[model samples]
Target: MTRNSLAARALPPAVLVQIPATSKANAHIDPGSGSFFVQMSLVGLLYAGVAIKPYWRRTKAFLTGRRSTPEADDESSDS
Candidate 1:
């Protein structure tokens, strides 16, 4: 017999398995999870922007060789 025929004969038939309805794992995220992810992403982005604003201003000042406005400086002085 040829190698191709021998290889085909060695493999068993494939069967499909069905899962029960009581499974915990989901194939797709529900709307609740989707909305939670969107809200978390927006909150994270807002905090990141707030956290990076100073660094962004400092980098801008360094590259331009000019100080930023006194509003940012005033905030630092209050601390």
Candidate 2:
């Protein structure tokens, strides 16, 4: 095709449209959750203590020259 024919088929100029403003009823601002976050952190610390309790017991036993007895050792199970 010729340049003249290509120029004739070019796209039209873009038209600008006005945007509508948002209404107050559609907008909502949330109050942040502070207590829930504190509770979560406390729960995390509790979980960590629970998870480390066995290792702490083993370390204490080793330091005190006492054997972590099978009866007291919850980390292992033997038949």
- lDDT: which candidate is best? 1
Model 1: weakest 10-residue lDDT segment is: 11-20
TM-score on alpha carbons, each prediction: 0.44, 0.42
Alpha-carbon shift of residue 7 in model 2 (angstroms): 73
Clashes of 2: 0
- Tell me the alpha-carbon RMSD of every candidate: 22.8, 27.0
lDDT of 2 at 37: 62
Tens-digit lDDT string for candidate 2 (15-69):
1112343764443765347864665565444444444555677898999998876
Predicted structure 1, TM vs. truth = 0.44
Q: Where in model 2 is the C-alpha error above 4 Å?
A: 1-32, 69-79
Question: Model 1, stretches more than 4 Å misplaced?
Answer: 1-32, 72-79
By summed lDDT, the worst window of 10 consecutive residues in model 2 runs over: 9-18
Per-candidate clashes, comma-separated: 0, 0
Best by TM-score: 1
